[model samples]
Target: MHPKRKLTTVIAVGVAPLIAVSLPADTADAHGWVTSPASRQDQCFAGTVACGPIKWEPDAVEGPKGLKNCSGGNAQFADLDDDRKGWQVHDVNASETFTWQLTAQHSTSTWQYFVGNQKVAEFDQGGAQPPQFVKHRVNFGSVRGRQKVLAVWNIADTDNAFYACIDVNVRG
Candidate 1:
């Protein structure tokens, strides 16, 4: 064989496996956000709310710890932190079952919901793997009228959490 051809063949043989091995057969999907009551990101995804990059991946608004804000510490989805935006309001009674859609299921530590400074409900997953969907029944107590509810999903292994803000009109 010609010297150049031989070198080419050797290089191809050496590089082929690396290329194939680098290709992933599947990626572990592990992200989720509240959809019920129409979270801010969910509304953006539905075109009901005009937002930034979060409109594309509504469930992936993750950020570092101590993110009590609606953006989950991400500035790209900061529109969620704005109460002035015309977010769609879902009317509900004192209690409602909130649903979270998970594209990739991950072990969760806890799921919490807040209204202003008050935490109305929480679900402790305790590092257990969650299903495709997670549900929590939230109570508004005596609070009524329109309010922005914040939802936080704390991942068990990560230092980050996913955040969602849902606008709701509570009726007694």
Candidate 2:
């Protein structure tokens, strides 16, 4: 083949594959969820913590469901109480609050559960108690020594919204 034709052919061979690879990757909470044993004090998730089975109710006007720093829900942890993490003093009287939220995207269905750094109290969503927030509250148990908490979120649906939120306070 002619030099120009050969060069073009080689370039096309190399560049075509490169272009195809450059396509954006479909990421579905690829990082994985974060977890902290009851004995551990620190819990961190590099990304947002998505709650369980995402609830999707078609918007009256067709729009994404956005939830944020919600309040009221209960709390949850890998373990309710851990006797490990030997500490100078055990904290059993400490209490705090956390708020979580998320925004539901169109054509994205998935329940959100967050696991981020710094564990917070669990906040339940929807209640007979007024001042409703579309989020959950997590109550972190007690801590003896010193510890940090982190967590991340997860999804149950591939067609619902993917989002989560958490906030906590320590009073040990």
Candidate 3:
């Protein structure tokens, strides 16, 4: 090799390892999750219930825009899909406030709340970026007893949504 080419190759080899080391080992594109009324992943994060990887990343339960499962169709978070898991059930009033703790806010389309197959509440954002924290007043209406509420944050610019499931016992 030419003298100049040999020098260039030596510099490249020395700088490559430094560049790799300086880069982040793992990057988190986490969004958000229900903090109040304590969603399943939140329960796992808080150590209220024994869980898996979700304990470290409760804010990352995201999947495709339309999904009905608690784990957001993520197999790693499949623990959230297990109804038999000893999840803590909060006793809430007929009208309860659901709060979201956003790690990273995104341009949002809507926030939807559901019970079984029924949509109980929806707040449209119209492509606005949300704040670090968001809360919605959702009335249980006639829904009572032990129930699981699914909350979804639909992103306006992406074909994905952040999901969470909160277990509650609504007072009559």
Candidate 4:
């Protein structure tokens, strides 16, 4: 083989595979979600919930500016928005402490929980940095039976938030 042809062949064989197999940039943030009672992301990461890329990066459910959907406004995480997914329901009393396991601690403004359209609880951080584990004692009030809770973690510096949807049976 000619010198140029041999070099060209080597370059094509080595570089082409790398280009073809390369993934997108690492846009994953190290934020987190509820894990004690098992949030949807927790289930996905634990192989209980069938999910997409989120199964690999459970702590990366950051959303667009000011959008507080069940899936953190990310279509990749849309499985969390579905209530009929047969998610494992954790049984809890009216008042219970829910914990968020943070992979990367970010300055937070507040954490809020909602049942349907009604706000059930809020924990204000007041733009302070949080610990690796942030706990909130939430009360479901008069709610009973199977319920989906939407949890939001508002980042203080940015306009985005982390979201987690947890299915639970509210036992009186």
Best candidate, lDDT-wise?
3
Q: Positional deviation of 123 in candidate 3, in angstroms?
A: 0.3
Q: Which tens-of-lDDT digit does each residue in 38-120 have in candidate 4?
A: 99889989999787788888888888645556688788888877777768899999987889999888999989898888889
- The model with the greater TM-score, 2 or 4, is 4
Whose TM-score is higher: candidate 1's or candidate 3's? Answer: 3
Can you write out model 2's per-residue Cα lDDT over 24-125, one digit (the tens) per residue? 987533212112121122121211222222211101111123322221121332221222323122232244322222222222222233323333443232
* Deviation (Å) of 72 in candidate 3: 0.4
Instruction: Count clashing pairs, candidate 3.
Output: 0
TM per candidate: 0.84, 0.25, 0.87, 0.81
The ten-residue window of minimal lDDT in model 4 covers: 64-73
RMSD of each: 2.9, 13.9, 3.3, 6.0
Cα lDDT computed for each candidate against the true fold = 0.87, 0.30, 0.95, 0.87
Clashing pairs in 4: none
lDDT of 1 by residue, 1-172 (tens): 9999999999999999999999987755648888897888999999997888888888888888556788887777788888888988999989998999999787899998888888888889999999988889998899899888889888899898888889899999
What is the alpha-carbon RMSD of candidate 4 to the true structure? Answer: 6.0
Weakest lDDT window of 10 consecutive positions for candidate 1: 24-33
Query: Over 4 Å off in model 4, which ranges?
Result: 1-29, 65-68
